[model samples]
Target: MRTVPGRLRPRSLRTRLVLIATVLATAAVLVCQATGLTLMRSWLVGQVDDRLTDFRPPEPVYRDIADGTAPAHRPPPHETLPSDFRVYFYDADGRLLPASLGSGRGEPHLAEDITARDPADGRPATVPARDGGGSWRVVADSGPDGMRAVVALPLDSVEEATSKLLWFSLAIGAFAAGGVMLLGGAAVRLGLRPLTRVEHTARSITSGRLEQNVAGTSPDTEVGRLGIAFNTMLDQLRAALHRKDRTERRLRRFMADAGHELRTPLTSLQGFAELLLDDPDMSPARRREAHELIAQNADRMSRLVDSLFLLAKLGDAPTTEHGPVDLLSLAADGIAASAARHPDRRIALAPLGAGYGADPAELDVVEASGDPHQLAQVLANLLDNACTHTPPGTRLQVRVGSLRAGPRTGGTDRPGRTSTGPPLPAGTPAQVIEVADDGPGLTPEEAQQVFDRFYRVPPAPDALRDSGSGLGLAIASTIAEAHGGRLELDTAPGAGCTFRLLLPASGGT
Candidate 1:
């Protein structure tokens, strides 16, 4: 007993709409028929009353009675319709009365057995005649001379007219109801026109038209809003997909950069290593120098590769899954490691005004959340940037503190919209670590693009050429963002570059 939307037959919207309209139309017809029946009944009764009002006795009897004379023979009233209708009547005393104005009932009258003791004046009733073939209207009242009178007539004309009207009304009602149903169906289809466009757009998507977008212009009703909404949805999906594609391209470029970065040092290391292994006799000093050089190149290559791998891991990391890590210890350790690696070089610690402290230990373990290894990589990249750009005697600094990262990526500090420290925690605060150098640093243009993949500082005529892959800064920035923060660089011509790594503060989520 499993249910799945995939296995079920989806209902059609158009058919459903039409069905509802048809049912309503049927109801309308029934209502019209009932109304028509009632109205026609009233009209038929009026006709019967009209015929009854015209009921009058024979002319001779009427003349005799009108002149104040007694009638020799009394007769019933009748109408002559030129066809096969028998006119018969009864006197007030219940005896068969003759018709002086038309043909009498043929042979044995159909209404002969339905006689009633003189009916009350102004009172009338229809009685079913023999074999149920027809009916009789029996009415009684005083005559023109104060004499009693009774009238009986076959109801054939009234009945025939009633049957004709009933069928005519039903036909008219059915036709009107059918017209309404058809119009209703057209209206429903017209109303759902936007849906048809949505369907067309969806089909286009399925057929490899990634750029196809829903057109919302020129709608005449609420369907226009639907078109707009659908187009907006497509816009969002297209943006998401485009961002994904850009990420993939950047990844491929990063890998290629990493491989290229390693190749140069690896080539030197391999050549030196092979020389040391050769049987050719060499001086001890020369051999020692070759081995040391090879080891140094190998170390450089190893660090470069590790940095790139860390950047790649940022996107791959699961969101909100890693435990919190203290960024203070991480950055401090990285600075120390960079100093120790190049002991001959100079390093310094400086504080900034925004609550960032000067002491190396002053970089307290700020509670940040992320994969420890990736966070450590972010720290190492910052250190590497400081190391490469600084002169041997130039000062290097690292400062750690907290700041709010706003929901607006463009930058804002408004209340409720801003976050503290990092944008991680579904857009929250962060632990910011700034690493700076006093070496002749970046030009304004270079500072803006330094984090771009493959970008490099401009080479001066006599300056040292950049030997490492140009991806170090870019890789570091990628890692910073993957942790739900951004890398901001402060630099200008003649002013050293300062790099900031913002990581989400712990407890933010």
Candidate 2:
């Protein structure tokens, strides 16, 4: 496609609008002027023709011309023609008679062929004057003795009046066109001011000023709506950039933490293998101990790698195998496993509130729809996290029940916490599993990052050597989200930590 040259095409919207408006206005003015001029000329000529029709020469003048006795180049007695009118007579044989009458002004020389034309039945005709004075409007009629009488009126006055009006209309039209151009240009500029501001804002954003926004975003006009959409787009873009930045930061931290965790076990393995290899003559018992240490370190490294892989998988796509799972049963199994692992710790299944049965078997069943294996893993991680963090004697309880009311749905006062997952409406059915421990609780600052991957609270001096990896709660939180649920922590300084896993209930059991 061929494009118009920049100079020939209007570059700005304001200029185009002004140009179009001025053109239309000028065209309308020209049409009206032309119509007025034509009507004025027709009306003026009609008046002259009416005058010629109404006038009648004196009877004695016509009688003298018919008898061939009228004086040449002289007016007769009792002549009453207007000063602007001219009268002439023609013989019956179509020959010009010298006799004529006129005002004292110079006479117009009419053509002989025009004078000899047949009678006009009182209708007027326009003919050029041979004397070059101007044109004339003439009417011819038959006299009593078959002589032709012609009355001529000069058209200079009509032509002069119409010429003056034409010039006046042109002057007024030019003034009107200029006024329209100036006023229309200003109005168009005013109307497009918002667009100009939007363009400026877009440029600012392109230059990395994400905070810039278009002003005047009312929903009333086209420009206003455009500004509103532009602002909305900018806000979304800024948010996306922030999210991307956060993702990158988290990935870097994860990589650093993983490397640090792996390096510890790798150093231990390398040290023990060198010990066994260097001391070939050492006692058999020492060699066995060194080999066991090497195996343990190797196992630890394997677990860390597996946890990292699981996190990556969950992050990439959280899809899970869906199935019906009873949260109460899963909680029972998790408590049993934790008790077996730490025989000294008192881990037990308990009711969430006083409305439930006393017998564990008779407790209200809390059911949910999700991957049964994944849901079980979530329960196990929550229980393990509780058992590992608290002291051996600290009492830990697993509670399963259906939520009666929705939890709060806004950002917490705690710095590290985000908005409590999307609000579950009041009275909406949901399954909940909670792992509560009466141990040294976390502070607001600690609680914020407790769920972060590889984040672990500093262990007590008497804590066990196998404190386990810090990915349990983070993995549990991810699994809960994959199941269309959320993991929440309720704790404060000196208050026991309680991890709650809330999932939409499949149906009442």
Structural similarity to truth (TM-score) of each candidate: 0.63, 0.70
Candidate 2 clash pair list? none
Each model's lDDT comes to 0.63, 0.77
* Worst-scoring 10-residue span by lDDT in model 1: 410-419
Give lDDT tens digits, candidate 1, residues 435-502: 77767876656665677766667653433445356667777766666666767765666667667777
TM-score of 2: 0.70
Model 1, position 436: C-alpha lDDT score: 74
Would you give me the overall lDDT of model 2?
0.77
Q: Which portions of model 2 miss their true places by more than 4 Å?
A: 1-10, 31-166, 186-231, 276-284, 322-325, 332-347, 350-362, 404-429, 460-464, 504-509
**Residue clash pairs of candidate 1:** 403-421, 404-419, 404-420, 405-419, 420-429, 420-430, 421-429, 421-430, 422-429, 422-430
